[model samples]
Target: MTTFTFHGGAGEIGGNMLLIDSPGSRFFLDFGMSFKRHGEYFSEFLQPRTSNALGDFLNLDLIPDIEGLYRNDFLSHNKMKTSEEPAFDGILISHAHLDHLGYVNLLHEKAHVYASSVTKGIAEALDELGSGSKDDFVKTTKSFSYYENKKGEISRIRNCRDPEIKYSQREYPLTVDRGEFEVGSASVQIFPVDHSIIGASGFIAHAGGRSIGYTGDFRNHGSRPELTRAFVENMASSDLDILFIEGTNIDEEKGMSETDVGNEISRLITEAEGRHVFASFPVRDTFRLLSFYTAARNAGRKLAVNFRQAFLLDKLDSNKALERGKDIIPSHDEGLSVYIKKREYGLIGEDVEEEEKARDYDKKERPYVGIDNQICWKDVRDNPGEYVLFLDNYSVQELVDIQPVEGSIYIKSQCEPFDAEMELDWGRIENWLDRFGLQVKRAHASGHMSGGEIAEVIKTIEPKLVVPMHTQRPVLFSDLCDCEVLIPEKGKSYEF
Candidate 1:
């Protein structure tokens, strides 16, 4: 028997988790947090207490109620029953986006996690650059052997893999590959798809004689439009029984391309006279970073990024893991500079001792490697027009220090804010620009296929059953495609 369970990513934009149960295999498609559900209960200051983490989320239905899929420690802490073994064998991550891979820390220890090689490298880099908490992906360990157990006993039992900190790099479960692989009875073929992210992929999963073509999140307008085209063509020939696809931009028709955004940015920077440029984009969109990097170079200006982005770029570049266009990696380059915030006590603070620096990566020099070509806000303020700054929402606060004069430019090189909360954030961003005297400009390309584009893709593949996911209007897919559309609800199971 083959069954599909919608654990998440239903009638929403993010938080994609699903269960694929076949006679041979049981696994999850993603393990992410739903922003819509989370915002209803908690805020920045009103977060759930660590003592009641699982309880808080469970009470709100923010996470699933599966038994053997979650970590034993979390369930035990919440007074919930935990299975002695994991119910699922693994989780196949589509990409490194937070909406797709954020809740990896909640998985059972025995779960074997898989992603593309680039996705794994990006996840490791993000973990090194992200805040250290129990929810983090990479575990920090000083010793390679035994760890201090909860009971403070010297036990040498080794049976689990994750949810808790791995404590050692050797125990990290980041087994990544391309092409066909099996997780128990289920057979899966991973095809790289073009999305806003670098390692986004589509899956062709087969179990119990039923095949599912799942497009996690895809688009056809970026540096690699050909990739998506090929994926669509290939999946069309797969003769899948079910086609599961993301409809993130299904309501829209026309869309912009990455080349278009780069040309616009290049024009804006070249025409500006003595005005500094500020651009906003997703933190991990390496290609977008490179596009802005190219724009800055065209205008004869260096691109200044925050320490975290520099860490990601430096980690990816130093490892030489970026496959397609390794030369586009923007670290330790003349055109790139790390913007070190002049903080008194943060990670990049001048007062942080050499001995007390971060110890996540195997390399001893990782803590301060990317901060070598550091530039303070004052450096930018002194020579405003000499650099183009990348300051998305999180780093926008730094504008108070730089203090740009009137007529400076601000380019929002990302999608327009979608939800009410994001709309509020967009307003706040405008207020900041108003206060700082920066002229606002809009230029961006989406990471999802539009309605017309996806309709064509659906027609090409022409599967027996079509299920819309990663979109608010799944029912509308029936009108968009020629095949039978099934709008799967959250937590519902469908049999094939």
Candidate 2:
């Protein structure tokens, strides 16, 4: 018999942690931090979990009560015990998204971690870059093992045949002792999948005469649709017993395709009279960037990206068209040249030219060419008709403060939570726009599949059981299939 438990993310969008236990082994699908809700129990005083705050997990029900699961040194001051079972044999990370990997810092040294090579790289970079947290989520020297295939005896036999053969395999492998670990008598395999971010993957675990499939956050519209399809086909071919899938778009209407969204953005940029500024989640979909590039080219205007945006694009292997610089504003003499912000100029030092430094020239010495300003807040201030801005949720308020000239437009191009309880700040954007009478447009595309697309995927996979996750409405599964829609509550167990 096999038992499954939902510790979190059962009916929520984040904090996804699930436990599976079989005869000889036990494991966790993910251990993630929950985004604090306004006025919620832990929302008021919750800070990033520090070594000193391990006791807070007990009060907040974040971490489970697993005896000997974690090292004693990692615990907080006030240690309390719960009736919960011991920790699992290992942890399987599906991706590097903070929501999916946030709680990793809380685990013990004994917990083996697994992730794709690119996911691991990005996670390490995030730790080094210090975007949100200052400390590395995963310890630097901490050891982890990687699994490429989910097959049982065949995979093990292949590993034993030749040590050299294992090291030379296509996938990245971290050397570890397999005999030291067993998860509910099941072997685990991590399979790559398509998502908005690079290096996302799904997971397959085999145990107790059954196979379970967990599709981590995924999208079929990215560059790897066939790869996503192949994963589903492989699962269907393998005859999976139960499949856990994300349903982020289960309640959203069918959204525009990536291509359509790009075209709409292009149209908006081309029609706008003032300077254009765009702020978006700068990951995946190089096609969107290309759309902006093409539109700028067609309009005979230069493209401009912020320093962080330029850095991200360069990391993605896209730097051919960018002009390295130390200023947000471009030279008044240059024709259609892309300008990067100068705030983090030292970070990318020596590579940028001295002449590109807008700060070098004295205020009175700088030559002013109105039309030559490719990118600049000052350009927007002096000649708002010459630039366009693409703003994100974070920068919307700032953009509102700019108070652009008449006929300026703003476009929102990503998913914004519509829940009344969430009280997202974007809701205020609408009211602000109404107050200002600014012309606002919504030109966006979804990263996840629509209802019809998800239904198609379900039909293609044809699993014995379908478990929907990552949405407010898991009941949507009832519309697609008559099979058991197992909505396992937190801490409740389901047996097979």
| Candidate 2 TM-score, C-alpha based | 0.71
Name the lDDT value of residue 54 in candidate 1: 66
Superposition TM-score, candidate 1 onto the true structure = 0.88
lDDT, residue 191, model 2: 69
Question: Would you list the C-alpha lDDT of every candidate in the order shown?
Answer: 0.77, 0.58
Q: What does candidate 1 score in Cα RMSD to the true structure?
A: 4.7
Per-model C-alpha RMSD: 4.7, 11.7
Of candidate 2, the 10-residue stretch with the lowest lDDT total is: 170-179
TM-score of each: 0.88, 0.71
358: Cα error in model 2, Å: 13
- The RMSD (Cα, Å) of candidate 2 is 11.7
Q: Give per-residue CA lDDT, model 2, range 203-252, as digits (tens).
A: 77887777898887877775456657877877777677898888878876
How big is the positional error of residue 15 in model 1, measured in Å on the Cα after superposition? Answer: 1.4
lDDT of 1: 0.77
